[model samples]
Target: MSTVAVIGASGLLGRALVRELGTCAGWRIVPTAYRRVQGDTVALDIRDAAAVAAFVERVRPDAIVLAAAERRPDVCQHDPAAARALNVDAVRTVASAARQCGAWVLSISTDYVFDGSAPPYRIDDPPAPLNAYGLSKLDGERALLQSNPFGCVLRLPLLYGPVLDWSESAVTSLVPAVVASQAAGARPAPMDAWATRYPTYTPDVAYVIRAMLEQHAKGQAVCGIAQWSGDEPMTKFDIAVRIARALSIDARLEAQTASADATPRPRDCHLDSSQLDALGIGRRTPFDVAIGEVLSAWPAPTPSS
Candidate 1:
């Protein structure tokens, strides 16, 4: 049976990857977590290059998925050192370790690498990151490829799915604001209506990764750059509206026509998922249906004392 080592198994997409690959026949999963290591999840700090190397030698899986990163845009802008530590340095560490152990690596990346001036970004499009987070991810992508010939980069757009809390994802985080706005005499909640986002489902991404792994097992490892994303585009206001609808609550949500985020964001960096589409490696759950599934598990807030 072939084995795959998944780093950052405690995070949103990482959990989904583990859950998806766990069901596949003839596969063994070695999941690692840094902050919340528990159960079968191994404790690993990717930033510690020596420890990472040691871990790789011990596990020696056939493939590795590097999913750990400091993804917050504002945080990245404020603390670039930390972002680089995880997104870039840690990526290099993982790729190097994987290469030495004869394992291929798949590193996660973001569409923010582009300036969002263009629509339907292809794999070949020149990246022009506007913020620290995007820049770090772009650098990390380069680091992975540079460190390992067998490494691949999968760039994704904004994501949402099974979340620990509404704050865990941008799409789900609007729930609190939506609920608060519905209260009598409450002020309208302002939401960004400028930047468009594609809230791809994490489980669907896990499914695609499993397909790539299946291909790798067949001696057809996917290398270099590839991308996958949800087809639907919606702004924060749009998503909030849907959340309100799902809850059957009429909420006051104001559309912010102009950009308000302190950190610079691209207007529409909609990644053209043609590469994965060509390989028939993709899954898309409609926003309405998928959002409902996410919200169902979330218990309503307790009333104020």
Candidate 2:
């Protein structure tokens, strides 16, 4: 009899969350989409406060998962205002509306909030974002917490899984590029080797969210911020090698130092999920296994004859 609304139901993580949560018994999943509508997902523009407030008021969901955000770091760098509008302002709007409706909010955040100086970050680590995207997300987290004291913030690292588009996720984006390079005999395509990333699977994240929601429904105190990361750390080059090996393609990828790039990024933002582990609410699927599952489900592009 409980209703849960998933905003940004069309994106990579959004879709996975909808799929995972929909399977749970005794829950009504209300999926909202913008720009793209799939199945019964309602179209929504979270940036429009009136529209969001109206939707939340109408749906009156018991819980709202704020999964939509302007996530691309480069995009945020180019237009910080746009990022703030969605990442920060919209979060406040949603949290405020959720508070009014007596609905708990769960906002998705990123590990980018930390600078590369730190290796594995804990829940209480002070955030020093290197990019506008990170700053905006951190702001969103603050807004969500301030607006709804009982709300939760889940910080995630690089994620990959069934994506609406191949280039949507940083992790899966490497697959198409490597595939193209192999077809064209382009050995050693330049990839970032300077920074390390913990690539998590979206399905695993969805599973964690479901578990947390179940606990909350059972009157468990699951509020506050928590981190979830993949089991291992790997550079972009390392990921490309794994992708190539998984697909039986040539592993021709070169390493490009991240520091050489003009844009600043966290060199290492591996998150510590010990808190989530202690709560017994999250699981970390191995990177290789997760990647293989994604590839099995992905409709890979065929090489031109």
Candidate 3:
């Protein structure tokens, strides 16, 4: 049984990691939380260097998976400084600490690192992020690589999954809203004409992380800049329609709003997992299948308190 400390284990990817790893490898998952949650919760504030170091030293985990980040695009745009503090600086502290402890760190990253000028971007493609959130994640990736030679950065795309139960984003908010709207016979507005992006299921990503950990432990020469995402590419509009369709709702109720009318989004944030496929490292889940799984896994929403 390996000792893995999954920071932000309460988040989407974190929860999936705990659930998947808990059952498979008998991994003693120490799910760190700033607020609180079940199982070995720790008051870990990644931004605090001394505190981060202290947590790492005390835990002495064999592997550290840093999934904590300020993932909100609008919020990052509103406050780039805060985004940097949490996304980049905090990640640096954790990576540095993990390096000192000789623990392999796999920092969860984003596809937004690219400017989205191209589609199906390969791992070797140069990144030119168009948004603050993307920039911060890019910074985190660079910092981790430079800080620790053994560190791995797994870049991801638009993510969706069961963890939406606690998420505050529109993706998370929209599912329940759409379900309610359909239940109420009202059409919920869905944003169409937004950029095309690769949407990755959180559970599939968790599996890839476990695979990476297993491979890395065996001292394999795995690429650090690996991309983990769905098999096919689709726009937000398409994603919304699919989600509605999965629920057997009139997907037409999903409105088509343009990117101009919505928040800042990359025009083409789709990534290429071919490199991962070539190396036999990353796992690919079909987008449609992923949507069905996500919807199926979503717990029945309750009335607002």
Candidate 4:
């Protein structure tokens, strides 16, 4: 069986990857992270070149998925050095390690690399990042490509799903906030922004990775750049309203004051997944259906038995 290693296995995306891989055939996972998780974990920081090299040599994995990064734009803006260490340098280290180990590497990236000036960006478009986080990711992608020509660089948009822990995704963090707001008599607010974004489900991302892995096994995969996102494009306001509707609540949303400084969010960070779909690798889930699924899986209140 081929062994796959996830560097940040305890994260939201990492957890989803692990769960998705459970259903795929011919692969066992070796989950590693800086912070230990409740499984077969090895303590390794991707920023430390020596440590990363040693870990890769020791694991000798057939494939390495690098999902660790300082993902917050505000945080990256505040601490550029830390972001470089984790995002750029760490990626370089891991990519080098993977190249040395002859392991196929897949690096998770973001749409933040674009200024959001162009909606529905393509994979081959020239990247011009507007923030430290974006710059870091762009640099990481370059490092990976330089380190190994046969590695995959997957650029993703907004991601939503259950949080594996506190240090997971912001989209995951919004779950309880919305639920709590509803519990506190706060209804969903409507948004009227023309700007839209593609929110990729965590499970869908894992599925793409699995497909990419299978293609890699067949030795017919291209390793340049691939973009993935939900098929449907909707404004933030639309998503919030949909979530409320999914909960069987009245969709009562109002457009709030919009500002550009709201976490450096792109006005329209949509992606073109036509090529991905044509390759039989993309699965598009409607926003309404996804919201309903998310709401359905929500924890139910327990009654005293």
Candidate 5:
């Protein structure tokens, strides 16, 4: 069986990758976590080049999935240096080490790499990032490609999955606001209606990655840049409405039609996943179904809830 090393195994996507790949019949899993290290998880910081190199040399995985990054646009804008350290520099470090160890690397990127001015972005589309987060990821993509020509860059859009806290993901974060807005004499909560996002489920992404690794195990390596995103497009308002519906609540949400974010965000950077579809590598759980599953985990808030 081929061994796969998962970096950032505690994050949303990393956890899913561990669960899906760990259960696969043809693969062994080596997972690492930084802040939330566990008994079975290996502790390794991806930012330290020597540490990453040493870890890769020790594990010598057949494939490495990089799901670690500072994905917050506001954070990236405030601290471009920090974003560069992880998103760009660390990616180069991993790719360099993976190439040395003859391991295939799959680095996660974002649809924010595009300006979102265009619709259904193709793999070959030119990138025009309007924010620091997107810029750093674009650089990371280049770094990985330059280090290992055979490495793959998997670009994804807004993601939401099982989370320890409602604030953990953009989608779930709106839960509290929707609930709070219905409080007695409470004002309507303003929700962003400008930017459209495809909230992909992490487990589904994990399944797709497994397929990618499986093909590579059969000597059919996927190289260069690729993307996978949920085809359902919804703005923040739309998402909150669905959440409210699932919870059987009359969520008081005021649609904010204009962009008010300090950090520039694309209006609609819809990614075309026909590339993955053609490979027969894809899964998309409807937002309502997936959201219900996620909300079911947490007890409904009090009457104020």
Candidate 6:
């Protein structure tokens, strides 16, 4: 039985990976958390190099799936040091430790690495991140590849599914706000129409990782960068309208042009998953079907009397 350590195991993506990977046979799953500790998940800060080294020495996992990072652009813009620490420095730490222990690494990255200037970016596209968050993640990717050439980098887009809080994911966060506006009689809440995004499902990402792991076990080369994004490219407003229609909510969503946010964001950093497709690694779930599934699992909004 091989052991797999999932850093940031309590996060939205981490939780989905844990749930999905747990079902696979012949693999022992070890979940590690930082702030929130839950069932059998060990607490360890990836930013601390010494601690990470020690943890890796102790567990000696066959693979380390790094799902932890400072994901929010606004937060990264406000505090770049923290972002660099978690996104870049921590990644280096994990990769270094994994390399020493002869463990393969699958680091989770984002589509933000590409400037929105180029739509439908390929795996080999030169990264020109538009924000601190993207830059940090790009740096992390470099660090991982530098430290462990045998490792894999999985670049993902906006993900949503099984979040502890609405704010945890970009897609799911819209639900509470839309519900609130509807309750307050605030019809047509402003939503961004300028920038386009692919709202990929978290479970789909987990499936991709599972496939990669299986390939690695079979001694298949799964190194370098691979992307998996949602098939449909829609703006936030488009997503809001779909959500409203799905739940039969009477909330009107006004389409507003994407403004100059504190952190400059790409207008359409859509990713091309041709590499993953070639490898037969993952499947794309339609956005409407995925959204309905997510909403069904989420807590229903309280009806206004």
Model 2 clash pairs are 188-252
Compose the digit string of candidate 3's lDDT tens values, residues 1-305.
Answer: 67899999888788889888887755777888776566567778888899999988988888999988899888899999999998999988998999899889999888888877777788888899878999899999999998988888888887777754535433555566555555444555555555676677787888888888887667773547888778666766676677677777753445454566334667776777776677675666776776677667656353232
Poorly placed runs, candidate 4 (over 4 Å): 165-167, 180-194, 260-263, 300-305
Model 6, span 1-305: residue lDDT tens: 98999999999999989999989899999999999997799999998999999999999999999999999999999999999999999999999999999999999999999998978899888999999999999999999999999898999989988777777888877876576667665565688888899999999999989898888888885899988888898988889888887888887677888564667999888899888888988778888888898888766565341
The lDDT of model 1 is 0.92
**Candidate that would win on lDDT:** 5
Per-residue CA lDDT of model 2 for 1-305, tens digit only, reads 88999998888999999999888899999999898886798999999999999999999999999899998998999999999999999999999999999888899999999997877899998999999999999999999999998799999989899776678899888877787777665665788898988899999999999988887788784788988888788998889989888898875677887556566889999898998798888777888888888888857665441
Question: lDDT at 126 for candidate 1?
Answer: 98
Worst 10 residues of 6 by lDDT: 296-305
Poorly placed runs, candidate 5 (over 4 Å): 300-305
Compared with the true structure, all predictions reach lDDT values of 0.92, 0.88, 0.77, 0.77, 0.93, 0.88
What TM value does model 6 have?
Answer: 0.96
Please, what are the lDDT tens digits per residue for candidate 1 over residues 1-305?
A: 99899999999999999999989889999999998888999999999999999999999899999888999999999999999999999999999999998998999999999999988899999999999999999999999999999989999988898998778888887888888887878889999999999989999999999999988999998999999999989999999999889888888999999999999999999998887888888889899999889888866442120
TM-score of 1: 0.98
Task: List ranges where model 3 is wrong by over 4 Å.
Answer: 164-170, 180-188, 221-223, 254-257, 261-263, 298-305
**Ten-residue region with minimum lDDT total, candidate 5:** 296-305
- Report the alpha-carbon TM-score of model 3 versus the true structure: 0.89
- Give every collision pair in model 5: none
Q: Estimate each model's TM-score.
A: 0.98, 0.96, 0.89, 0.89, 0.98, 0.96
